[model samples]
Target chain A: MRKILLASLLIPALALGGAGCSGKKDAGESGTQLGGTVHIDGSSTVFPITEAVGEEFQMLHRGVRVTVGISGTGGGFKKFCSGETDINDASRPIKEKEALLAAEHGIGFIEIPVAFDGISVVVNPANDWVDHLTVAELHQIWMPDSPVKTWRDVRPAWPDREIKLYGPDVDSGTFDYFTETINGESQVSRPDYTASADDNVLVTGVAGDRDALGYFGYAYYAENTDRLKVVPIDGGGGPVTASHTTINNGTYAPLSRPLFLYVSTKGGERPEVREFVKFYLQNAATLAAEVGYVGLPARAYELGWQRFESGKTGSIFNTDKARSGLSIVELLSL
Target chain B: MTAGEWRGVPNLARRHWQSLWLRRLFQALTWLGVMLLAILLFRIARQGAVWLDWDFLTSFPSRFPARAGIKSALAGTLWLIGLTALISVPVGVAAAVYLEEFSRAGRLKTFIEVNIANLAGVPSIVYGILGLAIFVRGIGLGRSVLAGALTMSLLILPVIIIAAREAIKAVPQSLRQGAMALGATRWLTVRHHVLPGALPGIMTGVILALSRAIGETAPLIMIGALSYVAFVPEGPMDGFTALPIQIFNWTARPQQEFHGLAAGGIIVLLAVLLLMNAAAVAVRHRFQRRR
Candidate 1:
């Protein structure tokens, strides 16, 4: 009887497996006949864009499987350097330490700037006193060992209430970008603020507290505009809000950073991976915009394609000169 | 005062009042749990009901929130739990039977028993790391459904063994004695009487264990189950994603619509869990009735 029951269960499972196999064969007949898997793992911030691109790419080529995983940027790099993944989606450029690891593994990569993500400073909708924050003011508020305690501390006329701070956790690429841009060093910040890895939790924290000031990806602020008020940042030029146009035009200043896709040189050798990368670059602009990220300029994409086509390996962004804050177009030209 | 009057009059009245208060307190606590669950379900249903349509069940996940579905995730979850159940149930039950009936009580048995209890309390992510080393990298399964299933099996094996051991122990010792006295060998007695008596309990434990496996996300994620799988997995060797991972991915998205979709996924997951629990109840009822 036990054997009979097991057999009965196994039969249905086998039937379902058969159905799934047949369904794949049917899908394969409808598109370009490229067959293989493309594995991508990386930053959660860049996941939406890559997921969108991978979805459309798979629709066009049904036999090609694209699997995108979010293990954060650093974790993804570990796998990428170890040759476990074909592509690494990163919201920031590869760091010096990560580059060394890649070199140690003999894993060369071509960096492709996919999108622009602005780190938007936000406050609760109820607080109306704030207008715009200069880079220096931002530094004063967020810098380590600073003494800004209340709204009056940042500016006398703002308010007298205690100011609450929130931000992405240390593991986040957003946190790294925000800290580096605002505090003049990566991962440096006052330790009093509430931090969360999930942007939604940060959103909720800022939205529920009137005195809360938080920073996260522009997409999050865009999603919760009604509940949150965005503070425009003044970078030497003027106060510019993080809009699509401002971010794309590089007017969003230091807060606007380019997102990237680091393709392994060895994985690029596979025909499926090569074609998928091509598909990704060609469609990244549209898909990135659709997924609430600022698309790179057309010229940037052209230059990126040229670099990929020429089999350019290693990181151009590894140098101090590149880290001095060049736009994607400028960096690509280099 | 008389001894009976001293014991009964005010003392009985105070004891009665205390019992009534305790009953009311316990009743209120139970209702609180039920109310909280109801509120949660109502909120989820309100948000997700509009999104949980036929297309949402049948189609694969998409970039557009309106088109995103749980087809691949649902299928992957079924495959994972099924495979996990197959791998863990026999091994877990055998270990339980050996420990309960066959193994002699000694230092080694006691040590093994204590370790199994300790293993059940270890964090799921630690098992994930172990699974990543043993299955994905060591055995070269490479983030496939088989790797995920093996990891989940490791996670739930202790729970199943403990539960099965309790169930098998519940079988009356007199039945085993009767079977042996009737000239049946130890294996035959265990097979015909002991196991039959314990089957209902073991089935319940197995079903509950599988339900737990169905909801796990961390171990699968550690083994590299991709969140964005547009195609259904055709075999154990294929890469897949589970319901919790998909729901987590949706909830983490910047779009508000995806949050609603996550609620829809949760509803489906809850329904699967409810059905599995119901099956456990039904199986136990049927087997108990037969006995």
Candidate 2:
């Protein structure tokens, strides 16, 4: 009886899988039409915004389905350059080699800024006296071999308490940016911070501990304001709090960054693609702010549109490489 | 016999064309399939190969993505496999031995047999949800390594049990009768003879299950194996990451070096997978030699 049942069940399943194997080629072509499923993957950091946009975008254009996957920035880029996705939401700029791979695979792309952000430093709301910290102090706290293990060690007036930390995981772009700014390199930090890809965990961690400090994308701090304390960084002369005014004025001190969305140029000529991108940039200022991050200036969007139309982006931004612009000291204001 | 003498028809000689054509077609199709598979593996190997290195394997993930390593993740995966083997091997083998050797062929047993088949066919993701509920939340294990291991054990139980039963059932019934005729107890015959012969196949099944568990991401992720860990877990209660988790994390970055790193991580994973399969083959061959 078991033998008969096994034979009856297994034969059809194997046949079906074998028959359906031929359908993979036709899957990518019909994707431009309405009601089609646009499978988007990558960037957990950018997921909320894209998901929010995808949700409303799908509703506005009925029959069109958008599925967003959070695979992280570089992971997303591989998929994007492989032509597996329409738009790649990235937390950082594409590297030169990634562009080369895309080109090798016939994946032409355009980079557009969706919004601005101030990568906020946060702490548990109970840490009262740590309203401001110097950039050097941040270096001391996060550097590989620092003697400061406790809040008391950081400052004599502060409590002699163990300093707990919660931050983005090693894979996070936020961590990348913070490490670059604070350590003058990427991923050089004391291995004491409890890390997670989900910002919510960091929020909860800091919120639950009075002595704990955390850092993540600015939007997270803004959304979970009641739970965490946003710390001000003293660039050099004055301690600057993170705000729309401060971030816009470029005084947020080392935490301010531009958010980007990379779209394949092969599909960029399509009307739906153009319209979608236009909608994204036009609404980015409002939508990004609504999602608790700073928006880029109106002119920034205008310039982006002009560049897209003209088919020229400044060659520097077009390719990723270290240019002879300035030193870290020169680029960042003290 | 001559073809003409056998067939009694002139056209019989020409029928060889049809036979030749069919054989040629089958051979061509088989080679084509093999070639396509080779191409796919080559592409995957090329992509994942660049990321494999001692530095990549040993280091913790960095903001740069490519510099990230799988030290903690490797440790965590090994631990998960160890715990899973501890729980699953005995339960699966015992259930198989009972159903195949001792249990009376009855309606109740038949019903149990059908349910096991059904369980084997259920999607892996469903097992993930079951693991989340039963082991993680129901048992209140709280996203620990133990919780992840328990979920994996459940996922592979049906497959292991089915494989074990098949191995046990394949043994000639004459051997069982011979042992029984010599005044050997039912338990002793099963223990000494049936088990040794079945051990090879059962081990193969368990090894395959372990290999599948190593590559599994969804259930592990659902059970709270987060994307980053600088330190290897010291116990089942500690937070952990796995090799796939690290690979997935690195591959998600847009950095060139990171993509390279991800490719390297894939190479390492494939190597681990291949080595385990090789070990399984060696074990199976050893058992066959004894038989």
Candidate 3:
């Protein structure tokens, strides 16, 4: 009876304590009277860039809070279209299905190009039998039902060792972009490969095996160049290596793609959202380089600011097909 | 024969020496395993001791390694385990009681016994896929804490049931016979005798199962738990992430500092699991002392 009485008393006391804790958190924002929350979610590939921008934005506006989440590109679109998030970070342009869903929900979005990324095909540093690969070889290796199995299968003069393939999982935007550009269709590729949504895992897998080949965002390869070797690709013009200059100048061919941030126009109408998006565009070039991605040219950033400032809505590229091999200038013109 | 007895005595002494050496060898192997674990703990502590702080515990996750915290993930793990224990304990314990006490030896009992054993061994990732299909999408739970907990409950349910069954089986059969012989019904005998006697063992198994649930990341990942959650969950339907997922997200980053953060997170997770196990042992001790 004494224990029961103590428990009864403690339950109410605990309830009061919980209420007091919540009150403190709620009172914190009202004390400053300065900020609202900004929700951002999307591609892991673009996560570093967004996270950097969010950190700076939050520091500038102490009254504001920014939350960034990584759920891959497709997962972000699902939330963005349903009005769950304010901004969506995408590595590739929005697909038609996603755009239609957003339209149906009355979520008008402005697409802004933030940086240039080259999808790099990498091999272990110890790999000695290959220097470069043609687009045809990448296709033969990646295409579904293709019979390419060994290093010698690609070329008779190459080593006869079995080829170990590793790459991004199907959920990744990088996977979709690579497949579309190399295999002539999005989401079309062989089922046999070690895949991970995390680029570091793919990097480790390739780095551990001499016969392995994998591809991911250039930023990952840049960070782990000591362990992995980047392979140049021949795109009918000639073999070209992936670099800031090559990707930005459109010399990287087929693999050079611009990264994007899609903001909900409804979210833009809010003052915090407007200020944060403005801060993002103004500082993207600097922050992009800081995070290992090549920043877009000043003019591109200016155009992006103009588009966001003017309240322009709709995707520039034909959403039915992800437009590959297009320069930033070409995309802007379209 | 009298002369051979002298030789046999020496041979027996030699065999004793060989057996003693084998025992020493096995002892060394057991200590090696413990030494490996100690080395791992020391290495992690050396790397992450400076990084673990109050701010690291309270702050939300950040892109910058210095600013990142596992507050939400820690809270999410608490919510998940609490809900999982609530759902799995009663169901698992009840199932064990029914099988051990009420059910006769039959085909249905044998089938259940075999399947529960198999389910306990099913790879955790398969449970994740099952959770994704049945709870996340089919039931439209949408990656909430409740959905993740339900999936986790399913994943660990088999283990709990198997453990509870063993505890129930260990209850002295004579005690049940005595209660039934004293004019008590089957339910009365189970309630007064069997459950109390098995409670300590059942608690230990349940706690261990929950510790495993707390470390799982794959099923939650498959169900699309966000890697970054700024706010603590206030309700079951809120989106959440767990400590293992947070550690995984941090470890996968290319930056070197995040590796330290992952180590710190691991230390925190181990501490939580250890505390839980300690509590279980304390509770068992209290019950044993009362008896």
Candidate 4:
């Protein structure tokens, strides 16, 4: 009976296997309408905002194919510089190396600051001793070869227990921004820790262990406030917790940074891409707030629209290296 | 009288029709299953076929769906399976051998047997949590290749032992008796005859178990495997990513192109599974011929 069953199962599978041997072309062209594929890929931090825009934009322009991908900021820039994507979502401004690569590929892009994001340091809800962390303390905990091992090591009054660290993986813009701003260098944090590109994993990791400490986008912390405690940061002006008021007013200090969408000059020339960018800017402030990011101020939005309208090319951060810990005002002046 | 009673005519047409219906039902069910598999294979192939090239296999994962490759993930999977096999095979086989040959049945034995059976039925993700606590935290192995392999080894150990035990049970009792009767010690007789006879079955089980381990993404995820690993693991202690995790990451991305890449990753995984099963069948066939 088992042999019969086996043979009966195998025969049809073999037949289907033979049928599957052939292939088909993915012809995406649709007959006569405003239609073209607009590919967007970038930081998962920026993913929620782009996805909201992409969905609403698609609803209005049914003929256009808008796709969004979360490849982390660095990975997105890699694709953007290679001319593979129409728009690149970034949690931070484009780095000097990324701009150089884009120039090398002759891929001129316009950078539009879309929103403000705060990277929130968090610990388990059970962690009561850590009300806030100083920048020097963050450096002590995360800087390469630092001596901070236990909770007691961070402060003299805390309990003695191993500090289980979790953070974004190297691919993440969050990791880059955090290390750059706090440790005063990019990708220079200590190698020992639990890391994931997905923020939820880190959230779960930190939430599960009492001694666990981690950081991710402020939106994630806000969403998981019940399970995790967001740590206030003292940037030499007393501890300031991440909030809409603090993040929007730029009082969130070094952790508060602008999010962006880089549009290719060639792509913007296309009617679909041009219309989409216009729609994106008009709705960014509204959608940004809806997605838990601070909408850029009215003036910043105007400047962004102006920049896009003028076909502004090259990055405002035109240097050949990452400029860390810069405020939105400083970036705007530059 | 008895002969006459037994000679009553069989219900020929009824029996024939009943058998025919049963056979048709089986065929229909089989085809239904086959249709589902065919649809899945067809969709994956159509989506990913264009992207399945040498570069896709060899290149490191990039943010650009087109530039992203599975080099790190592919290498990590091979390393995971290799290390898992090394750890589980010896331990699983030994446990099976001791349970089958070394001891008499008792409450202790019964308890172990029932627990092993239950362990086989536990969800894979639960094992991931266990590994995170025991290996990643308790043992401080971190989320390295060694840690993942150890976790996977535990996940598949019960299945391997159960398979090994069944294989060992099938070895003829007389063969062991014959070897012992010829002045061989009990250990020698079991080792030389029983173990040799069960080798093919045990090997088949181990390979199939390893294949299942390779396809697993949950426990690895729970233990904090990186979603994007740029470099291949150089040592067992180094960080790594597997094919399933990479596929999951790509599919989770909002981009249509990465969805295609995820499909491509699935195709590669299916191919690896098929290869392992083929090897198991070949080994079984070779052993059957020798017997």
Q: Write model 3 residue lDDT over A1-334, tens digit each, in one string.
A: 2244345434644664786466658647566443567778888778788878887887777656676667778878888997878899998898889999999999999998888788999999999878899999999999999798999999899899999999998887889889989998989999999999878889889999999999998888988889999999999998999988788677898887788999999999987898888899899988987777888878888888889999989998646333655567656755
Candidate 2 lDDT tens digits, A49-121: 5644654565476544454545577867876787766777787778778888888888877777666678889
Best by TM-score, which number?
1
| lDDT score of residue A116 within candidate 2 | 65
In angstroms, how far off is B243's CA in candidate 3? 1.0
Q: Give the TM-score of each candidate.
A: 0.95, 0.52, 0.77, 0.52
Deviation from native of the Cα of residue B222 in model 2, angstroms: 13
Comparing 1 with 2 on DockQ, the higher-scoring candidate is 1
Interface RMSD of 1: 3.2
Docking class of 2: incorrect
What would the per-residue lDDT of candidate 4 be over residues B1-291, giving only the tens digit for each residue? 233354464665666779999999999999999999999999999999988999999987765677778998898887788778778988999999999999789999999999999999999999998997898778988667889999999999999999999999999999988998899997897788988899888987887788889999889877656555555665677667899988987775535577799999999999988877787788778767887
**Best of the two (1, 4) by TM-score:** 1
Which residue runs of candidate 4 sit more than 4 Å off their true CA positions?
A1-33, A318-330, B1-291
Order the numbered candidates by lDDT, best leading: 1, 3, 4, 2
Q: What's model 1's overall lDDT?
A: 0.88
What lDDT score is found at residue A314 in candidate 3?
Answer: 92
Cα deviation in Å at residue A256, candidate 1? 0.9
lDDT of 4 by residue, A12-52 (tens): 44654543232111122433345665777777678767766
